[model samples]
Target: MGSHRKPRPSSGPFNGRAVRTVLLAAGAAGVATAVPAHAATGPARAAIVSDSVFSNANRLHHTQTKDSFTVREFGNVRSASVRNQANAASVACSVDDKCRSVALSFQIVTIAGDVHRLKAVNVSDATNKYCDGCQTLAGAYQFVVSTPDPLKLDASARRQLADIERRLDVLTRSTLPATELQTRVDALAGEVNGVLKNAVAKAPKGHDRPDVTLHRRLDGWPGH
Candidate 1:
């Protein structure tokens, strides 16, 4: 009923940038149907986003579009179960000269609140356009997010870690006046103690864990 649509893009691994662009465009066009996972954390945590979907068929435009997001998580998500899906079907460009499926896009966050732009793991029927008959182009995923034992550190903690590292490097590498060097050493010791102390304080109370593994070299992203 419409002009020949372009052949779908090749199926392959998730291209986060490309998906992100598609999602943004859809959002701008008011096509997106769901918000991201609730990110608020406190005594009252935000509810999980159970499911979201966008399914539309414009016979006038001879196009079909579908998008779904199934996401659930904890404020400090030790584990998560996520599902993302999308399907775009079109015969050919009708009034518009462009044709393509809009895939999934969202960012992943670590336990300590590190934001990472990641495309949902997908099995998609990328482009099935200009076909003899309409067929569904679908993307499916079972995304599981679990904290790796424990996150290394949040952004602020990472900074403190860096400062501690810098001080150690100076203690070992830089040759300074004895008094100044001793002063620096003392400060370094204090910094190290402060970090360890902070960790101890943050440890869960009344919980019995054999030992906590401190990821001294761990780091987190800026935006959560």
Candidate 2:
């Protein structure tokens, strides 16, 4: 008869603790392989904001939630262009509809002759450093070019002059504080210089000639 055979243990000589450690390591490796390496998220971006002012018989308010945008200023804008209508369930985009969105871009010649551009979306703000709302003096005026109608030179010039004067009056009487008025004061000075160099003199004098601005300290930002 053959000698009695001894049964060997199925498990190796490794201790229970070591075996558990190996199993845990393998589980961790499997988890790592299942996850995607590029599944990381980026930092959140800041909200883009601008202080807009406009009127068309009545007034309009709009909002844009695009990543980047563009703009055009001071022209013969129409009311139909601004979709300030009912339920307005769609997005009103800017002049450039590259985003394939509903447009909200509008141009209006104020009674004072100041051409105003209001775009709830798409139109990019004039910035200095890089993107919208990115600089100390960054504004939504990247396309603030004047489209003058030579036929109405005297009329247009007088209107714009009146706008400058009105802006000066409102700014001077603003109560917002000096910080807000500082830039406006600077802007007023620039307007005064520009209107003088260009076409205000040819126009007749009257309320249209808003030359004298009230030098009052106000904090209300100019709506014009």
Candidate 3:
């Protein structure tokens, strides 16, 4: 058998002890800037931090958890008969059995004398880019259209106008900071508003009106 040879040790003058000492010193200096362990974890400080964090998380969950709803919005609605021209209409959906405050959608097909032929479409609050909060609640939908007919606006149209205005107010004032989804929502709201405006003012006799918006019921919470 061939005789085994010992591997030559490193030729450097530096020994393990010296190298280890240098490394330890360097490591200590690097960590020196960190906050002291005792200062970083006082009991009072820990309790405060934990409470704040928990409160924020709880608030977020409360906001995100949806209430049950059966409302839906649909396009291309029809009257009883394909030829039966319907008059001004409105549709309001309340998820709550009471329908006290429901989500609503509306469309104006044709204008009559003083009445704008309108219909309620559906309620939808699916998460989107613009209004992250769509039909979060059940509400009535209303629309007003005016034709050449010189009739007075009905109470239903007025009610819808007021509701629309209220919703707009809430959206502008209570909306949170923008997100990727919000961009899409803004675009959709703009499009819907434009359509409603055109339909509402189709009659030379009627005037274009601003939407009424509601005040925010939940604003200024510690967290969203």
Q: Which candidate comes out best when scored by TM-score?
A: 1
RMSD of each: 19.8, 33.4, 32.9
Model 2 per-residue lDDT tens digits across residues 41-121: 111111112323221110122221111121111112211022111011112222232111011111111111222333332
Best by lDDT: 1
What lDDT would each prediction earn against the true structure?
0.32, 0.24, 0.23
Arrange candidates by lDDT, descending.
1, 2, 3
For model 1, the stretches where C-alpha displacement exceeds 4 angstroms are 1-58, 62-74, 91-103, 107-109, 112-224
lDDT of 3 by residue, 1-224 (tens): 12111222221211000100000000122221123323322111100000000011111122221111111111111111101110111112222211111122222222222212223232232111112122222111222223333222345544543444444434432334323223333343344445445434543443433231211111111112
Q: Which stretches of candidate 2 lie over 4 Å from their true place?
A: 1-153, 200-224
What are the clash counts of all predictions, listed in order? 4, 18, 30
Q: Model 1 over residues 24-109: C-alpha lDDT tens digits?
A: 11122322223333322322212222232232323454433333322223333222233344434443433334332222212222
TM-score of each candidate?
0.28, 0.21, 0.21
For candidate 1, what is the lDDT? 0.32
